[model samples]
Target: MISAHLPALQVVIPLLAAPACVVVRQSTLTWLLALLVSWISFAIALTLLVQTFFNGPMSYELGGWAAPLGIEYAVDVVNAFVLVIVSGVSSVVLISAKESIERETHIKRTHLVYTGWLLCLTGLLGITITGDVFNVFVFLEIASLSSYLLVSLGPDRRALTAAFQYLVMGTIGATFILIGVGLLYMMTGTLNMADLAQRIPGVAQTTTVRAGFAFLVLGISLKAAVFPLHYWLPNAYTFAPSAVTAFMAGSATKVSIYLLLRFFFDIFSETFSLRTMRLDLILLILGVIAIFSMSLVAIYQSNVKRMLAYSSVAQVGYMVIGISLATTTGLTAGIVHLFNHALMKCALFLALGCIVFRLNSVDLKDLAGVGRRMPWTMAAFVIGGLSLIGVPATVGFISKWYLVLAALERDWWWLAFMVVASSLLAVIYIWRVVETAYFKTGPVANTEEAPLILLVPTWVLIVANIYFGVSAVDTISFATRAADQLLSTF
Candidate 1:
């Protein structure tokens, strides 16, 4: 009976921990509990993923009622893979949260901060595990509400404005999704995703279904910060506390991308989405623009955090490109980048967190000579940058290789070239940070390195980057399985 509830436990463990953190009210205790909860969630994700591989899809009915009536939690390779990444990254980032929280958040609000963190974690996991379409919207809002509070908790006043902007955009996005879900319910009479999929084909050509699809795509695009709709991301990431930035950077929009894949491939028939709607072409055009424009924007950013934020938008572009191809190879690339980019961006942001620990600023000029003072941290940043540049034997190279191969498989040579060319932009921006940290001398003569706690977790992600880059068989295997599961739904 206990074993039957893994999906429920995956989300409930974190959900329950949120209140415990508040009740404890001691920062240290709260941090420990949060860390433990995150790791437990990660363990659950691993278990669920293994179960899926061995047992096919596993479904857990809420209140012991079957689907289309009672809610269900479904696990397949697709979401199980994402569950692992989200929970894994959250656990790693929480390891360093104590120091980062102390440095960047207010002392009086520490308890509330941990509470919000756990709530955000709960929401994200819930979103990934839920099998009901309406439940997706509910969990998405839970994550969104907690995230706004998390962003606003930063010591910087700009964090307030950033949170507000994110709130406005996020609210609009949620509203659109809700409306779309309502429309679908009106037409299909069921909210369970599997049930809905079984029903959608009967009315796929109806105006209501088409409108629902449109709203869902636009709403999800806004949340995912797809190009031309990404105005809220840079400020939000730049102004949030470093730890907050790291967790969100590593997982948030990636989850949104997962939703896109889920909806496009699973809920909606591929014939309707790719053939009739022609979303493939739309995503392709936007993906290309995002890759070039966001990368170029990243190159000119003065703040290192802001530059990385823009880089994230560009990285999303790469994922969108994979989605546009609508082939197994393309989807595999998208799914792999979802994991790989999380590794690189989290490593980069955590490195920035280390720098912020000592220097209190991540502006390009402020980073001058930081390499000498904080060699380990700067070196981590450098390695992460190389991965961002798609150098051979790094996770980025593996991801971009798949992307290029997917493009060429479609005979889109220009797209193949664009994939390679975008990495050049990554190089320029990464070099800016590297040059400032290594070549120029700081005005201050003496400085200390980041604490071991922060340094250790940062290096963990760094090592993962190199390790996964060099030995990608396992990761690629997972991606291929997830891709097959997605495409098979069609």
Candidate 2:
């Protein structure tokens, strides 16, 4: 009975906690409630991942309704891995949020901040676990709306502007997704993803189906911050509170990427014409461009947070490259990097959060000599940076090794070379921060480090980067299963 309810409880726990936080109206109590909810969700995700692995995919129909008639929460290898990533990152970020929230948001609105945080968490989990196509759009908007509120709560005046821009873009993305879902419903007369997968093959030749696929891919790509459409991400991440940035940056776009994988490999694979649409080629070209161009942009950023934001886009390119390869190996690489990148980015951003907490700045110049003052925090940054560069014996290296192997499997040596060269760009940008932090000297003498409360979570992720890298069998196994599940749908 408990196993059967895991799907519903995964989203419901956080969904209910959002309203509870508002009604309680006590800032510290609300934060504690949110943290408890996030950790519970994380545990539930682990159980679901293990359950799916041993028992095959599990589907829980809402209200005892079955098939095309009612909504379902399906947990397969594909989304089970993503559920772990989203809930796991949320737990880590919430653990560090209390101090960051007090510093960035007004005490009067702290309860409101917790409300939005839990709502955002609920929406993200709902998107990952839901089996209805229309429900995906509904949850997407929920997350997007709360995301705007979170960004707007940042200390800077530009937070308002950033939030507004994200709102406009997020609305457009959500609308396009709804339109695509509507078109599919028109053709199939079903809202459930499984039913649509079965119905789509019959309508594969219809222009409406092709158009819907096009719209969905473009819309999801925008949300995933896949190059050209990524204009909203840098500003939003840079201006949002550090904890908010860590949570969203680590999990949000990855959910979009999961949506893309679900629709294309699961739904469109039934149609078998996505390849004829030349999507693979398009993604490969765009992915290569994104990898190089965004890394270049990151190299020039004066603000450290914005720099990492651009790096996020570049990292997304690596995922796209894996998807574009259209092989099981390629998909496995993408899925593996999806989880690994979340770890590295969270560690890096949380380390920056520690810097911001102590120094009150994330400017490259302000970080000068920080390594001496905050050795543990800066050391975490260095270790995270090494992982970002795909250095040997770090989680990043494992992802890149798989990516290169996938490229070679496709006989695309050039793409393999691109992966290595782009990693070199990460080296340069990370070195820029290292030079400023350890080598360069600040005028003021400072000797304060972040409190243990923040340092513990930050270092935990850093250690994971190494621990998982050295013993990557478990992560690789899960990713391989997810890839196989997606590919088997073909």
Candidate 3:
């Protein structure tokens, strides 16, 4: 019977725990509560994903209300996969958060930090699980607001500026999504995504509907940090507390990409989004631009975190490229990369968190001799970096191989070439850190490795990167099934 309420409990547990964190107002206790909530959420998500895999889509109505009149939580292969990613990342990140949070923020503000973390997690899970478009907007705000709070808690004074910038841009994005949702409601008279999907084709030709589509896509693009709209990301990641960066890097944009897939492939027909709206070409052009430009930008960043931040934008481009191809193989590549990139980026950031834990800085200059000084931490960084470069036997390679296969399937040799070229650019940025940490020699402040607490979780993701890469059959299968389900709307 309790299993029947898994859908509600998935979000409710964290949502309720967030306030309890503030009420407890004790750092250690708040962290324990968050950790427990995150692990439970992960368990629920994994269960839901497994159930959806075997049973197909599952839907739950809130308060026994049914159909288009009430809020619904829907699970399919696509969102269930995302739920696992978000909650799983939160669980790992929180395991290491206690050490990182205390070092980077005021000790007294620790409860607030944990509260924000839970709220952010709750928001991302809510967005993924909810079937109502309105609820998506609401959850997006919760995540955005909490992210701003977490970012502002960074030790640097510039963190306030970063948080304010994020707040402004995030607010603008939320407004766009709200307006788009209102337009859809006006046309369909329903907020439920399943109901709207059934009605959208009737008004798909209207100017209002077209405008709404544009607004919605634009809004999500901003949130996902798609190149031109990504001005806030580098600074936010550069200055935010380490654990916050790690969690958000892994989850937030991935959820935005999930929304894009949901809207394009589920709510709007593939024919409409790809053919009528020409979204495929639009995303292709932007994706190509983002990959080349952002990777080049990343190579120049002095801050290691900022470098990875720009790389994150480039990685988004790869996902966009896969989505733009609008074929099953293409969507599979995009979806798989969504999962793969999360693993690598989170690992990379966590490794950096370890360096930050000891050195109090992520500047390249500060990282000199870190490879020798903190061998385990830098080792984790190296593996994560190699994954970022898409080297064979790493998860990044798995993602790119699928993407290249998708490109070749379309006879898009040029696109495939660009993918390889962009990956090489990643090598340059990643190698910059490697060269600095390993090759460059200098007096360093810390010679000891990060504590086992941080190193364990960092390597957990690092090992996952290699494990999933070598044994990619299951991941590929899951992504393929998710892609097929999405393209079924065509």
Candidate 4:
């Protein structure tokens, strides 16, 4: 009977587990507890996804109170999909975090690490499920605050600087969201997203709605690290602990993008988002420019993590392009890419984690012949890299294939050409590592491969990447349905 409310359980389990992790006092216990909570969250999220799929949609009112009067937890296919992404990614990354955290974090601070991780998980889940716009900002801050701490957990002193930069940027972003929410509340006297959705249209012509939309878009864009606003990403990714890097890479920004979608499509009417505004054009142009510019920047980077960081910005461009198209097909492409890219980034960043474990640095030249010693790890890297390059039959190929279809739906053949061109640049950057690892002789010729623990989680995501690319029915169906829901908002 309690199982009926899996939507609320999905988030409540993680939110309540975080502080308990700190209270546990043992690192392994904390990690184990956190892992159990994460898996439980994933299971519940999956259940919610299925329930919503079969039953149309479900919303749980907190304490049995009705909407607009109490906290509402909504679990449509879209939020359910996001729930799965956040929980699933966090679960997989947690499997790889045990040893990485042990090696990188101070002995006395391990409990803090576990606690912060749990809080971040809670934040991500909360953002996805909350129906209140103000609660979204609250949970976003929870996640952002945890993230700043995680980024500072790196062994380098620069981690402190990176964390500070992230703190400033994240605070500003959160402030923008809060102010926007405040404006919405001031104008409409309600904070429930659905209520806002209905009320906002009446004020669509007012300066307040426009101001709220602008602030929300800009704030979420910065949080998502869209190009020109992504300055905090490279350093944060480079300086964070391996586990921290993997977790944030897989989940954080993607969640922010989900928020952006919920606002532009669901909260604000399509009439305001499309015809009354230049959002589609702006997103399209920014996405294309980011794709080309970041790809170019990646080729010149000496630091591998920073290189991949820039690559993430470019990959975000693909998703933004999908959103800008605003077509059903384009949205499907965008949401599917969000899921696929999370796995791809997890695999790639896990590979970098392995390199860091062995050599303690991600400098491209330093990686020379270690591939011979770390064949499995390097092989995983190559597979993920190939996926990044959009090699046919890989998961990336599936994403771009749909993206191309989306572009053609709008008769934007130049976008198709640009997609191919960007993939070519990906080939160059990814091949640089392939050439270094497989073909060149290096200084560290006898290093051992990564531990099985790390390799297991790394391969889990990599293999899933291939599996999904080949068998995309479930993903396609969910994304398609999600697209329909978003577009049906009109």
Candidate 5:
């Protein structure tokens, strides 16, 4: 029975756990439930990925009703990859969050926090697993709503303001996506992404199709915090609880990028949007601007979390640049970076979570010279930072290598140079914190490191950064295959 309904179980396990969380209503109980659900999602994601890789894409109609008429849960290499990212990262972050949450969050709200975490996990996984466009919007909202709540959970009152700011921007982005989805449905009379892909091209020349494509891309850009649209990110990350910030810094925008890739490569005809409308050039130019501009901003930030937040904007440019190249190699580079950057950033943020848990601050001044006292934690941070700088033997290096290779593949020499230059900017920004943590002296001298509860997860991701960096074949292969799947449509 479970075998037959694995697709349903993939999403249902976390979905059902949300209510079970409310029923438990005790902080420790809720924490255990949340951890169980995340682990369940992680197992199911792995099972689904295995099933898809071995068996090809899998689809199950709700109530056994076939689509384009019925709702469907689906899995493909692209989304299977994403499901693994979301669930796998959430599990690691949860172990660390257990300690961070207790210190930073109110005891009374701990149960609510766990509930939101489970729902957010479910919503994010649902977005990746669903086959229908309307369903994407629904799950996007579910995740966004939970995200707002989580961001506001910090002890700082500024977290409330940040959450509100994020909510306002998120709502606008979601509305735009909904309208785009509605436009596609109105034109094609179908909501299934696969079916819409089949139908939209029949009417691809219409102005409405063009408009829908524009709205959809723009909406995704906003949700993904692409470049100029990233105003809400820094504060939101800076003020959010360590656990929430760590999880989101790694997962949220990455999910939005998945949606953007799906719509651009699958649901819409690239000939119309990229060729006729010239979105490729526009995206390329904006991507370059984002890479440099945000990296420069990152260098001067006083707070470590906010700096990383800006670095995320810069990373978005790399993914966009890969896509704008409009080649299999280019898309493969972008997709692989999506996976690589998630691991690297999650590790970095988890390291920061340790710092925040111990020292109660992510400020550069606060991190001063504790490097010796918190050697393991700071060592993990430095390694994660090196990964961010694309150092020789880390995940970051592999991602930038692919991005550079993609640029050269397009004969875009200037783009290739820009990629290198962006790496230089990354070096400058990552160096700031390194300087503060290791070079400068602290005010008092005896500040200790965060406990094993947090360090364990941080180190897990830190080691993962190096492991995936060294063993790049699997990520490269899956990304290439997924890119081929996407480029075939173009």
Candidate 6:
């Protein structure tokens, strides 16, 4: 019976624990509560993924109300995989969060910080699990509001500015999403995604439907921080507390990408979105621009966090390109990279958190000779960086390989070439950090490595980067199944 309710519990546990953190008002107690809730969410996510994989799609109606009349939580291979990524990344980030949060934020506000963390997690999980379009908007705001709080918790005054900027942009995006959902409801007379999916095709040619599609795409793209719309991301990541940066860098944008897939393939139907609306061309052009332009921008950044932030925008391009191809292999590539990028980026950011722990900064100049001092931390950074560059035997390489194969599958030799070229740019920026840490000389300071509390969780992600890279069969299988299921809707 409890197992039957796992879908509801996936989100409810964190949702309830957030206010509990506020009530506790003790840093240590709140942190333990957050960590416990995060791990429990991860376990539920894993169980749901297994259940979906073996038993096919699972749906739960709230209060036993069925169909379009009440809210539903739907679990399939696609979002089930994403739930694992979000909760798994959050669990690891929280494991390493205590020390970093204590140093980067006011001690007295730690309970609020964890409260925001849990609320943000709740929002993300809720967004992934819910089947109603309106519920998605509700959960999106919850996540956005909590994210602004987390970003503003940084010690720097500029953190406040970053949060404000994110707030302005996020509110605009959410408004667009709401308008889009309203238009769809006006035409379809339903708010449930499954119901809308069946009804949208009948009205596909209407101007109102087209306007809704445009608004939804624009809104989600902003949330995903797709290039040219990504102005808010770098500063937010740079100014946020290191643990917050690590958690969000891993989870937030990836979830936005999942929504894109859900809409393009699951709700809109690939035939309508990719073929009739020509979304593939639009995405392909934008995705290519994001890859080259953002990677070029990253090369000149002085702050390591900002550089990686720009790099993240570039990586989003890879996933976008995968979706743009609109084939089974292409969708599979996009979905798999969604999972891989989360692992590598989180590891890289967590490693940066370790550097910040010992050095109090992530500036390249400050990291001079850090390799000699913090060997393990820098080594983890190197591995994660190699993965980012798509070096062999790393998760990044696996993603790029699929992307290239997808491009070549369409006889798009030029597109495949661009993918490789963009990766070289990743090499340039990553090597900048590597050369600074290992090769440069600077004044000696604390040569001690980061404490075990931090190093252990950071390495956990690093190990996953390698383990999944070498043994990617299961991930690829799930991604393939997810892709097949999405494409089946056509």
Q: lDDT of all predictions, in order shown? A: 0.92, 0.91, 0.94, 0.89, 0.88, 0.93
Candidate 2 residue spans exceeding 4 A from truth: 270-273
State how far residue 101 of model 2 sits from its true place (Å).
1.4
Clashing pairs in 5: none
Which structure among the candidates has the greatest lDDT? Answer: 3
Which 10 consecutive positions of candidate 3 have the poorest summed lDDT?
A: 439-448
For candidate 3, write residues 177-282 as lDDT tens digits.
9999999999999999989999999999999999999999889988999878888888898889999999999999999999999999999999998889998998
Alpha carbon deviation, residue 363, candidate 6 (Å): 0.9
Candidate 2, residues 68-162, lDDT tens digits: the string is: 78899989988999999999999998888999878766657688898999999999999999999998998998899999999998878898899
Candidate 1 vs 6: which has more lDDT: 6
Q: What stretches of model 1 exceed 4 Å from their correct place?
A: none
* Global lDDT of model 5: 0.88
Residue-level lDDT tens digits of model 5 in 1-490: 6866887887788889888888888888888888988998899888888788878888889887898888998788899999999999999999878789889877576788888998898888888889999999999999999999999998689999999999999999999999998888889999998899999889888888888888888888898999788889988988899899889977899999999888888877666667887989998999999999999999999988999999988999899988888888888889999988999889888888888887888888888897877899889988998998899789998988988898898788999888988889888878888888888888738677779989999999998999999999988888888898887773
Q: How close is candidate 3 to the true structure, as a TM-score?
A: 0.99
Q: Model 5 shows how many backbone clashes?
A: 0
Worst 10 residues of 6 by lDDT: 441-450
* Model 3 clashing residue pairs (backbone): none
Tell me how many clashing residue pairs each candidate has. Answer: 0, 0, 0, 0, 0, 0
What lDDT is reached at residue 268 by model 1? 94
What digit string (tens of lDDT, one per residue) describes model 4 on residues 1-490?
8767787788788888887886787888989999999999998889888988999888889888899998898779998998899899999999879898777666576878888999999999999999988879889989999999999988788989999999999898889888888888888989998999989888888898788788888899999998778989989998998888888988998999899889989999766886688898989999999999999999999888889999999999999999999989899999998998998988999989988888888899998987797999999999999899888777898899999999998899999999889989999999898888888988887699889999999999999989998988899999999998998883
- Model 3 residue 154 CA deviation (Å) reads 1.1
Provide the TM-score for each candidate, comma-separated.
0.99, 0.98, 0.99, 0.98, 0.98, 0.99
**Per-residue lDDT value at 467 in model 4:** 94
The alpha-carbon lDDT assigned to residue 295 of candidate 6 equals: 98
